[model samples]
Target: MPTIWLFAIVLVTGLAGFALARGRAVASAGGDTRVMHSRPLYHGLNGLLTAMLPALGLLVAWLILQPVLLDRAVVGAIPPEVLEDGAARSLVMADVRRVADGLDAAIAAGVATPEGLAALTAEDDVRGLLGQAGVALGSDVSPYVLEAARDMRATAATLRVVMWVAVLAVLAIGLGVALKRSHADYRARNFVERGVLVLLVAAASIAVLTTVGIVASMLFETVNFFSQYPASSFFFSTNWDPSFSGRGGGSELGIVPLLWGTLYISFIALLVAVPVGLLAAIYLSEFASKRMRSVAKPVIEVLAGIPTIVYGLFALITVGPLLRDAIASPLGLGNSASSVMTAGLVMGIMLIPFVSSLSDDIINAVPQAMRDGSFGLGATHAETIRQVILPAALPGIVGAVLLAASRAIGETMIVVLGAGAAAKLSLNPFEAMTTVTVKIVSQLTGDTDFASPETLVAFALGLTLFVITLGLNVLALYIVRTYREQYE
Candidate 1:
């Protein structure tokens, strides 16, 4: 049976077990609710959990293990000549799988008989027959590959049948045991509660596991990159050229220019975002009327809801050209539409909502009594805000700014569309420059060779970006904690 059909059967059985167990519990209590240790609902949930959990666990394990075991068995069956190296073995295995799938398709379409397929040989034009049945092959089928493919198909079929039988047997056994234990004095509520707590812990562990997986994968690839390329050249050199083919020893893979562009663009973005967003937040939280606040806050937040790609397009067609003509060219800075200024300006506009919304809430969280006390001490409104409200909210405001800075640094779309793909360490904002993210995308695009430094360097770049962002977060936390303690 199909996996989905098996899942449906298990689910239906569990649901049926729930109803049966609930009825049994009520009957054991003599239809008196107060006589039972737990509610009917808890008893029902206990039965459902018992019927489903073991069966689902077995099914998942079987699915993960089956392919691996079958692949090993098939690989053993193949001739030693075909298993030359890792890449060669992988390619041959791919062909074996494709041929197996094609044979299955041909049989399903009635274009090939089972007996004919069993009797097939390499000399019998197997690829032509498969092609006639709409299964194309890149090369002629060899005898060894054909044998391996046949073995793989047969093993997979057998394992699938075994999986279904085992899962069903477990489900039946669990349901019987759960129903037998459903008595008036049974601790069904405690069992169900413990199971729920286990599930919650498992859910939380997934996030931690995901972070570990990301770090491990990047670290492995970065180690490979550094093994082939010198660490000193990658870190300290100012050049940024990468040879697509891993042929040249002269390919400069330095990250200095990329890092400079990233920081420079982020700095410009913050220069525009911090003042505007902070001022807007102060006005909205402190001065705006209720009617205006409601309307204006939502309007400003709508910018955050707008997609980054839309902002990229705005930067490309509108903002980039506008800056080049109106500001950069007139001031004799540069004539390029795609420049650091264009991307930074558009990215800043995109970050405004992050700063304003967070700062507004942080400012509003300050106690009203603090402001009142300041006013009674003969301080003016402006003095009261600067000395009392902003000071109290300074930690949160700094955190908001740091968060915006992180967003700016990680931005890709605006940098790609607005800033041209030229990794440069120039100081002029009007000059075209690209960040590490843009180079990462460029290096990884198209038919990439994973073993090449050109491709592997993307992982190194990713790890660097991760470290930079992590340091920023740590700094933000430390600052927030220090100031928060003083206020408390």
Candidate 2:
């Protein structure tokens, strides 16, 4: 059965269990709710929780493990001669999967029967047969792959059958247990509540685990990179050059240039965004009437809805050229359209909504009594806003600014399209520069060897960027806590 069908079956079964257990509990209590220790709804929920969570969990686990186990088996059965040229087993496994999909498609197209596919050899025109099924193959199917595809299909069919039976059995057993406990005196409410609490805790733990997993994965790759490339050179040397020369050794994998570009562009972006966005927010929150606020706020926030790539294109096609022609060329700065200034200006425009929306909300959240108290103290509207309201909302504003800073630092598309990919240490804003995020993309983009330092360095760059953003977030949190404590 399809996975979706299995999911539907489990859900329907849980609902059925809920109805049955609720009816049984009510009947046991002679249809008198006061006589039962727990309500009929709680009894129903207990049955549903028991049957649904375990069966869904089991099905998810089965789906995750099935492919891994099958891939290992298929790879193991592949002949030694298939790997004589030392092609990656992963690539071969990909081919095997594609062949299996092709076989399925061919069967569906009625071009080949299952029995005929099983009897086919490497000498057969397997690619042509697959093409008739609309699957284009780069090369002819090998004997081992053909056979392994068949074996994989057979094993997968059996596993699916077994999985279906096991999941249904688990659901039935859980429902049976819930029904046994569905009497007049049992604490079904407590059991259901506890199960829900466990589920909530599991959901929270999964988030933390996902963060740990991301950091660990990048840390492992960063360690591999440092093992091959000297950490000192990567950290201190102010040069960025990655050699894609298949032989791969003589590249000066320095990050200082990239880091400088990232910081420089972010600094320029913040310089543009902070004042404009914050002032815009202040005006919208404090000065604008309800009618104007509703119309203008959404119009300004429409910038946020525009995709980053569209901003990148705006930078590429409009902002960069205009800056180059109007300022850079006239001032005898670099003549290139793709420059740090161009990317920063465009990125700042993109980040405007992140700051304005958040700051506006935070400012609006300040107590009305604070404003009234300032007025009672014989202060004018401007003075009250400047001294009372702004100070009260400062922490959240700082947080919003830092959040925008984090976003600016992580921007890739604007930097890529607006700031050309010339990694160098230059003071001129008119010169083309690249950020760490852009360099990470460049390094990992092509078909390259992963074992090489050049490729692994992308992970190191990624980890560095992650650490920087995390520190910014921590700082934002600290600012919010400290200021809020002092004032509140």
Candidate 3:
């Protein structure tokens, strides 16, 4: 049977066990709700948990292990001469899996009978037979590989049967045991609660585990990249060229220009976002009337909901050309439509909602008493805001700006469409440049070998970006904590 069918059967069995167990518990309580220790729903949930959890756990383990065992067995059957290296063995295994799938497809399509499939031999025209069934093989089947594939099919079929029987048997046993325990005095509520707590804990742990997995994966590939390419050259050199060939001597895999562009663009973005967003927040929170605040807040936040790619397109089609003709050409600056200024300006607009929303919340979080106290001291509204309110909310405002900075730094689409793909360290905002994220995309695009330094350098760039963001977050936290402690 297919795995999906098996899963459906198991689910249905659990649901049935839930109803049966609930009915049995009610009957045991003489159909009197006051007699039982827990509700009928709790009893039903206990039965469901008992029936599904262990059986499903076993099913998952079997699914994971069965493939490894099957691959080992089939690979073992291949002759040593045919298994020359990892790549060659992988190729042979690919053929084995393809032939195995082709046989099943041929039988199902009615182009080959079961008996005909059984009679397939290595010396026979296996490729021709498969092709007739609309399954093309890259090469003719060898005797060793053909025999291994036949063995793999037989093994997989037997394992499927075994898996079905084992899962069903466990489900039956668990359901029967839970049903037997479904008495008026049983602690079904406690059992269900414990199961729920375990599930919640597992859900929470997944985030931490996923973060660990990402870091470990990047670190491993980055180490491999550094082993092949010099770390000093990658970090210090100004050039940013990547030769696609795996033979790594020709490529100038420098990260300086990319890093410079990233920081330069992010700096420009923050220059635009921080002031406009902060002023908007201040006006809305302290100065605007209630109706104006309500209307303006959502209107400003709507910018956040619009997708980043739309912002990228806006930068490319509308903003880039306007900047080049109206500002750059008149000012005797560079005339490229795609330049650092175009992307930064567009990215800043994209970041405005993030800064405004977060800063609005943080500014409002300041106690109204501070403002009242400042006003009682005969201070003007602007003076009260500048002296009392901003100082009180400085830490949170810093955090909001830092978050917006990180968003600007990590932005990809805006930089790609607005900033041209020319990695350079330049002072002029109208000059074309690219960021680390753009280069990472460029390096990893197309048919790539993970073993090559050119491809693996993407991971190194990613790790570096991760570190920079981490440092920014840490610095923000330190500043916030230190500032807040002064008031506390």
Candidate 4:
């Protein structure tokens, strides 16, 4: 709900500010920035930025700080004895909140019993007497303590309401202002077009920001994890029994077996996905009739739309046993569908659209002029496609493959269901294997204490995955840039 509110507020502010600027500028004598400095749309955008930027900063700060301030005030009210025990701090706070809420509810309901009434009366009387004694006897502390407690409670409630009101008011004010300017001379089309561009850029920036946040979060946690477990052991040790004790009575947090499993399963998935996907893409792009493409493209995309969890179930219940008897047993592999092959194959099927769709787009985007030039040179369609079109689209093809690889590496559910949870560094595709994603899921899926290496290790694995994906994306961007030059 807060998220939805935040979005609505930001959008309203942006639109309102944009509209106001456009209106004021149009009404001015020399306001046309392009006709006088820049376009009317740019003027509107400039206003939007001015209005929303500072206020949104305040909104973000308020959102982050409100909970911390409330939590601290509530915690500070607890008695000192409860704070000394490690667990008592939490327990007493819960009880104190329950008592406060019960008091509020009882007072509201008019059902407060004699004991409840007596206890509250006693507390008030003691506080009042303490206050009078503090004033009459010239003691400086008792009245102040009571006053401070009351002030804290009231202030917390006030701050909560003010924050919500501020958020809603900002939204309502912004929306009202934007609507007020939607007149005939508002130039809505130009304003909307420019806004759409900004919106797209903002959307793209979130992906970059999300990647940065993940890396930064994992970096700090990984540092903590490495402090507890030596880096060498985590990277090179052949075992990955995180529940085991270290030589120094610490937890065993080695990663060799998990890394091995990740690579094996990913390799199998790539083996299954790449050739099939590439050939299908090649055929569809170069040979398929327009009618076939119309039918096939949507069907392939539908595969991508299927949820990964569904594929996981398909692997667990249907594919595992089928492979155990049909493939594994015949090949002298273990008779289990939860082998590397089962998950890898199903995951490969999942990734086919990823590879094919991207490749198709790149291949199709290759200029028709190049195809015509090859034809004019008396080259066959196949030859022209292989030599000219593919070469021109090579960088994009590589980018697509890299993207598919990243998807395969990060996939969790299918592997979790189809691959056995054995963290062994075995080369046999028929034997069950695990992956980093699977290990991360297994480690962090339940009620886990943050202090334990078992839980912290997931952050480390996440850091590794983030780094790998980041590297791949950067490489893809570079390749795409270089390929853009070829077409240009």
Whose lDDT is greatest here?
Answer: 1
Model 3: CA > 4 A from native = 61-74, 77-159, 247-249
Residue-wise C-alpha lDDT for candidate 3, range 180-241, written one tens digit per residue? 99988999999999999999998999999999999999999899899889999999999988
Question: Which consecutive 10 residues in model 4 have the weakest lDDT in total?
Answer: 135-144
Ranking by lDDT: 1, 3, 2, 4
Tens-digit per-residue lDDT, 38-118, candidate 1 = 999999998999999899889989998987888898987787876865435766888899999989888988989889999
Worst 10 residues of 2 by lDDT: 82-91
lDDT of 4 at 149: 38
Ranking by TM-score: 2, 1, 3, 4
TM-score between candidate 2 and the true structure: 0.89
Write out the backbone clash pairs for model 3. Answer: none
Q: List clash counts for every candidate, in order.
A: 0, 0, 0, 6
- Model 4: residues with Cα > 4 Å off, grouped in runs: 1-57, 71-155, 161-205, 244-250, 474-488
- Determine the C-alpha RMSD for candidate 1 after optimal superposition of all C-alphas: 3.2
Judge candidate 2 at residue 218 and give its lDDT: 99
Better of 2 and 4 by lDDT: 2
lDDT of 4 by residue, 1-488 (tens): 34557656776877877877677666662544443344566657656754565457567888689756755665555556757753445444443443434443454565554354344432355323333333221222233233333445455668867876786676556545554554435555565566668779989999999878877888888987787778998888888776624223455667888878887878888888888888888999999999999999899989899999999999999988998888779978787678888888889999999889999998999889999999999999889988899889888788878977998999999988999798887777878888999889888875455645677789998988877787878888887787768666
